[model samples]
Target: MKLQDHSASLSEVNQSVDTTVVHKSGWRKILAFFGPAYLVSVGYMDPGNWATDLAGGSKYGYTLLWVLLMSNLMALLLQSLSARLGIVRGRDLAQANRETYPAPVNFVLYILAEIAIAATDLAEVLGMAIGIQLLTGLPLMWGVGLTVLDTFLLLLLQRYGIRKMEAFIITLVAIVGISFFVELVLARPPMGEVVTGFIPSLPDDTALYIAIGIIGATVMPHNLYLHSALVQTRKIKKTNEGIRHALKINFLDTTIALNLAFFVNAAILILAATVFYKAGHTEIADLHEAHRMLEPLLGTRLAPILFAVALIAAGQSSTVTGTLAGQIVMEGYLRLRINPWLRRLITRLVAIIPALIVIWVSGEEKIGQLLVFSQVLLSLQLGFAVIPLIHFVSDKHTMGAFAIKPIVKAGAWLISTVLVYLNIRMVWSEASEFISGNNPWWIDGLIILVGLAFISLLVITIIYPWLSRYRMERSARMHPTKVTLGSLEAPSYKRIAMALDFSQNDEKIIANALAQGRPDTEYILIHIVESASARYFGKEADDFETRKDQEQLDTYLALLAGRNINAKGVLGYRHRAKEIVRIVKAHDADLLVLGGHGHKGIKDWIYGETVNYVRHYVHIPVLVVQ
Candidate 1:
């Protein structure tokens, strides 16, 4: 229920760090706000961005540079809003949505956010693996396996403190920047053409698709969650002046960091443009192709080496933050906690399995396409994160005096609308193309069905808030003054049933049931024998199993009688869950008490769990005593 309880531990790690600088007004004080944005900027220039930028530049020769610039501008605005939300409201985007939205809305948003994170991680994992493959001679699968171990090593650095981790990330970012800068100089792109490329232009449909990829890869969804939470790590005072100052300083940090990301992205495009496109190597859309061609085209081996090093740096850095984002999303949305290592492993495996499959089946050539597809998937889930962010920040109630300016709110809405439109357009374009391809009729039908389903989900996501508001208003109007029982009375269970497995834990279950039941309560002790004889013999097996269970039930009844508990016993032949539900309903029982061994792992799965089944089938509340 508390804010901290739902916030990610990564953000909580260095929370309230150095809060005593409110009176200071120098650049030294502003330095305290620099780390979070750099951490976020890593997402902007990750290896996924590399694939898109490389493709855009080599294939179209800087014509799609406008897309990267536009996406960065969008990133800057959204990330600033994300940081403002955390600073002004003291809640991350996930926590804000969780507190503001209804359960169903929150549940849907949580699912979308998770999908976005997984998609983001999918790109990061592949990027890191490809970087590994490029740097070393290892297979792509081996490189992916290596990434899992390397990520754990990087995460262990967090134990040194968040600042150290931030410093490490900045160091990697610097490496990427310097590597690209060096490549830019070696490639020697024409300034006039580069400037022309900056002007917004799309040559054709292929350019539009690649431009969308650039946007998707640049303005990531997970970074929004990550930045919002990361800003909370700082210790700013909870005052209007303090918040205003924090926002201004954080904006500067975001601007500087993201511009650096822009430079890195642009440098990637410029390198590809000058080195590949100008040299008539228009087919160099793939990262590996670009890497191989850089050496021969640029007439220097260092270019490819620097490219690979920068890639590995970008991939490694992004992987660390990707893991952090996974943890943040999981904890924020689901309010569930697992060991950080375990959570990372689960997410990594989810990504790794598919990456390995693609590598094995499709080979290394498909990695670039997979990376681009992952980014587009992130784009699909972007609206779910973006709309809620704009809504929360624009609302007077949520933001109070710190609510976004009218112009800013309008701009945010414009951006959200554009993103939503682009996503729908992309989906339609892709679906139409697929349907028109050489696929079978049934496959076309399936594609159409999936597109309709996706559109339906999008419509629901957009309209859920309105539906919730209307439902609440309708309920209020219909109910008027709701009546309630305000008495502190214990609930009575007149007809109670206890399920016994005849285990050693049965006594504890019986004791617990007695503790809750009144003296006059009727308790039915039931046990079902899952007799193997029922498969081989019919009536004889049923009678034999019934008699055996009856003796056990009689013994339980005698035990209950000795304790002065009014009770009866029943025995059934097979189908434990069915018989238990039948007895509960037949007796009109209010509650069911069951003995639970709390079995786990394989044994729990294979032997089945009776209490779970009964709880699902019956309306009565079933309590399991472990």
Candidate 2:
């Protein structure tokens, strides 16, 4: 017993030590990690950050540059943890947290994540309107009306590849970079103040809040989720050398993007200090103000033009990353495979409608303030999300070979504590000031309920670490859903509808499943050319099959089988594997016998669908008959 305990303790200690060296830090090869790093960087350059950065600089000038500098470095360090988690542990934060966390913790993370995405969408809409106003000389209202075009463009872009969309994003970043650079040079006031801006300090009701906003805007919670998952897409070899190279390139890409962001962030502040503060403009309450203000001083009518174009670029780029990140978060954590376009539409619609409503009721200035208010709420959401990321990444089990060092962990905790404190204090101050100054009893109720709920959640989040083992054991005790082959008794399922596309041996395998019959099992031999189904039917063929194809499919399967037959040849463009799962589950089949003839070319199997979508949605015992 003593020896076993000692061994267990040593094993745990070994595990703890291993995570430090987990990333296997090397850099001779950095090309592999570029794609995901670029995608992740979009979040850094998102329009929300621009809203805050622009506001920060215009409101407080170079004073808040420190925050931008600090936060970018912070984001770089934290985001690197995400990349290491994927490369070393072979799981993104979502997948890792799903396994490492309890039900309650996982649920909290998911809810916060979804909320963050929604909040970010709010700014993207504003950015879009700003862009339209820049390009076409339309009102914010009309500009917003036109942003639906962005969604259509996004959908069309997807037909090519995610990389093409990424390229477009780089173009946006470049435009943003150049625009900011020109503004910085044009507004050049004092080289000394700009240099001093890099040094951190607390500067009154001015840049301080805006600086925090810049920090908040940059290290978005969703991008962390997005980055972790995106790394797997590159198909990097699991070897240490390959993994190190991937990390190096990822660091390079992220560093480049974020460093650019730092400059732009600084530029915004420097320009604001030089142009707005020196000019004695007390208010820069909206995007229009900033634009109009620039026109008079820059001595160019193109000032508003540059402003709107930058806003549009920032808006569109962020929207893509937001959609992709949301997709990653949902799909990774909840196993919910939502369509990207539809998902993007939902977020876009949600963002657009509220802006339209606000514009219809109030005006551009009010709407823009509302966007800031939404961002404040986002600050709260982001506060909660950061805690878990910090907690999980610092854990030995989760980190495997890349756990944070003690100094780093301490610093992270300190930053997190201050963030939470600021958020709570701000919330209380806002609720009290708003409620006492002008609001009613419902505000009281809302404050009480929300505060209590947050407290309850915090308590649960704290206590969860202790209860996890017990809860895990309890979960383990529950019986799994009964999934058995040869259980569904049917006389007519011998008619096989084979989901056939990428499987050449599909016929051979279907024949084998027919020949190697489970006496009690009902067999639905299905050859589903889903693409063909869609082509011929001109609509989705859900076991909603055409009679001729069904009859012909039934006859073909009936020719090979020895039992009851009810086969259908359905055509649809749905994923073939998922289609099979849905069909088998809907019919309550005893067995889903897929034909894995394995006769396809290597390239075909690699590029095409072999296991179908089984890895994503299948829960039953799949019989891939040879």
Candidate 3:
């Protein structure tokens, strides 16, 4: 198959051609592969991580810094694998899952991925609002409301292209890194104790809970999906040598970006350990409380200001990635595309409504707890994404020589097993606590019911890949003979309808329609007048532009007459696609031919998507002439 026949990863912004044409070596070549991991890395040190790192640091006094280190390493490996899958197989994690699993299974997986994204966005909404409130003294509710406007900001950025968007994300990341670097300087954390904190130890169940949250916040599930799709944004050569080169360069990108993210996260925990724990205030879990204490404890007003600025930067950057992941999951699993703004609005609403209610019911004090819980919820969804990714990249038939080695496959499974065990343990601990408390009996029953459902889904995710592989192997053995195709029938059209915009494409559309028609076929020439007067008056309007449109249709009719073709002209006003569809049905045409304008991105917005609307609503075989 030709390359263009294959489906594009992100059709709107798929600019691999640009990268393919620009042949650069050395550092310039490496720079082309750098932006994707930076976008993926923002999810690591988002506002969600701030809540978990702060809780871990203030309560256990840096005992859980080891969790941060471990999670970062895992993230590095998994993200590299994700990039390899996209580069080798030309499929994202979600698309790979869709191709491998049954329809019902893919639907469930898509929902889970979306839930993880919403959970991530929930933390971002709260974190950004809190930061806004801290820095500008705006009400938290007002700040939450203002975040809805960010949808437009994202839309504006998208118009500029992905590289520009990546540049914007990198700038935010720089703001966050620089802010934390200054804060670590001001707090002056003890180097000796900080080094010892790297030794692994979980103090209690609470520490375990925070540690799980830390893992979830650091090694995000959505980032896996995002990274796979993001890597495809570059146009690399399809040869094995080219794939190997891309993989090597991408590993360097992932390592550098994630380590910077690690620094931002570790700095948060270390600063919290020094400023909050060493001062005898161990329960400084709330971000608001932490910010309030920063000035007096560190004896510098600049400390809290920098804290708020970094918080805002992290939230904004992470939210952009979260929405982008949502887009990838929906398109990959369902093969459906909607307006980007609509998707953003739906995701923001899902996160915002819950946040608004939580604040309204329990007040802002619960924001820290909510953020931590969201991260843990994200952790719970990790296995669904990670398992499928491992299965795809490890498949020898699919990945060929690019398949992961046995040792690497074993390492991936080990990580998966550790994540699964931790998640189970955390659920059990939380369930035990809830049941032992004075909570209602139904609440306990509900918890058990949800736990059973979650286990069933996870088990299906784990075993489906192996089961699928076994079934394929068995079928191959049964059908040993090579299959051959039979001849097919050709279709002939009796009545053909051609829609014209009175542009140069009208000739191409008419010629294609003639090629599909029989000698006795009748032709219906259609056009829609989009002038203002015709829109109001419809068929009765005798305006100058409408008359010229009618004249154009007559001109086409005269041309068809020279060939002794059965032809008639029909003109309608108002909505273009709607009128064309109506006229085509009225004429009972077997095939409809329309010209393609090739509009995309912001142009699709400006010039309404007429071709898409007509093709979808019309039942006839529609031919698009380019």
Candidate 4:
């Protein structure tokens, strides 16, 4: 088998894509569609939601419960639409946006989406750190610093497959759910009053502001990008029936997952209402204060303990999904893929640095404000994501028969309008407060300029689809004949290089390398000596491993010589991929043959991904044999 580069969405986990949902029926089939939504659902109840829900319930005493319900309903509809785009169109929100819009537009969209993810991650880092501080009595700064370690935890879980990662998230969700369930039991909130809280009434401006915050924070912008891509992980049939079945099952999955998220959010609000508002602690907003007051008001130590545990669970789960969203947006919009660890580390650090700076400069009292600011950042991007999603799923050319009906489209539009309006109101309120407190004229002017630019982008995004449709129709009528191109023949190899491990695969590598060469073509046998001394001394190292590698290369060259082949031996020290690439370039070889060790998952981490490094760095045709 020959290896080649594949630019699949979430290419690191491409092995899991389209491999789990094949040839199953009933519950087994339904289970395959269950995971993606769970991943998306975690975003709905992330640390960002905690601040808003806690604030609403404490300040308004369950009067804003209706907002959570309304937000949940909107999330279900929007998320289902997102999944339909993936199952029917095989494109994520980011990928669809890239294809639909111009390059500059997509670049801005990509940056906005990335900023939204970083903001979401900032909330998670703060929440997780606070939870650790609450539970272990550790300093908040240490807790914030320690949150960086979970990036490796994410890397480790990913090795097992998507199902394993899903299981881990589900476990965390359960912890949050069960923790709140116990808290509600302890608080014993009045059932009649709690039900009355959902009657859709805002008593004052404070209530309205909190209501806007609840709605704005509930529908995460990144989750829209994430759900559309995640549903493509399963392989379904190509027929209408297959698409329909996949859509139906995925809707069920989305409903269940998001409703569970609703329960978590509602429970947080209810717990806050019952414990804080009932005791006249209406100003409670900070998570640390909430946890501290829980023990005293609920009259049980367990209440505070469960609260801390649930917060940690929520933070951890949200961080995983946030990193995935970052990856999807970066790859989908930019077509750039990097090392997964490096990507995760970059995201975590982006969030972590801000968090640590806040902790060090302003202290833990400011974390709640930071969390709210992150939600505001998300609010700024919500319209940019939701409007495009609606346009894509409603487009007949892209969705075909899977295009949403007129009524569904109307409802999606109405929901998008309401969400965008409320988020704008919230963002404006936050911005006004900041501007009022600020001192510099340039800073205010910059904010105004950015706001105007944002509106311009939003306008262009809304109208571009119709404009693009018209342009296509006009072009098709004017130019009936389609453009065509001719294919070229394969090139002949003049010089080939075989990178050897001096193992059982050397002979196989030689055979494949020889097969690609012409009769008069020259070949170079290459190997790298990576011993302890060789790493320090380069080619001057005199070590047993170096001598052994040299002898192995000589034996391979002699074997090729006996076959009347034009071959020479070349050996280098230090890094495997770097040495192979350098030696191949120095010898002026046009082709490089490498043996695939079939390393994957943890083995890939241990042995290093040399083939990728060599292929990416060298400007030649690479043939990887397995």
Find the candidate with the highest TM-score and give its number. 4
Q: What does candidate 4's lDDT look like per residue over 296-321, in tens digits?
A: 89889999999999999999999888
lDDT of 3 by residue, 8-108 (tens): 56766764534444557767777877899999999999999999999999998988889999999999989999999888877788778877787788888
Candidate 3 wrong stretches, greater than 4 Å: 1-8, 11-22, 101-105, 298-301, 438-442, 467-498, 502-523, 542-548, 551-567, 590-603, 620-626
For residue 593, give model 1's deviation from the true position in Å: 34
Q: Each candidate's TM vs. the true structure?
A: 0.73, 0.74, 0.87, 0.93
Ranking by lDDT: 3, 4, 1, 2
lDDT agreement with native, every candidate: 0.80, 0.65, 0.88, 0.85
Candidate 1, residues 1-626, lDDT tens digits: the string is 12234333355473646644657667668887779999999998888888888888889997888888888999999999999987886667777666556677678778777777777778778877777778886888888888788655654665566788899999999999999999988888889888888788878877877888888888888899888888888887778898888999999999999999999999998888898888888866678888888898889989988988998889888877877777777666666665556777777888888888988899889988888888888888888888878877876765788899999988998988889888888888988988889998999999889778667766766666545543323221123466787897989888788888887878887887777788899988877777787534533575566567778888888877898889998765557788889888888888889977765444544777677578778887888887
Instruction: Give the least accurate 10-residue stretch of model 3, judged by summed lDDT.
Output: 470-479
Candidate 2 positional error at 224, Å: 1.9
Writing each residue's lDDT as its tens digit, candidate 2 over 458-568 gives 666545554664222222122446856776765343333344433456666666656645454345555454445654554445344444445656566666454454344
Give the winner by TM-score: 2 or 4.
Answer: 4
Candidate with better TM-score, 1 vs 2: 2
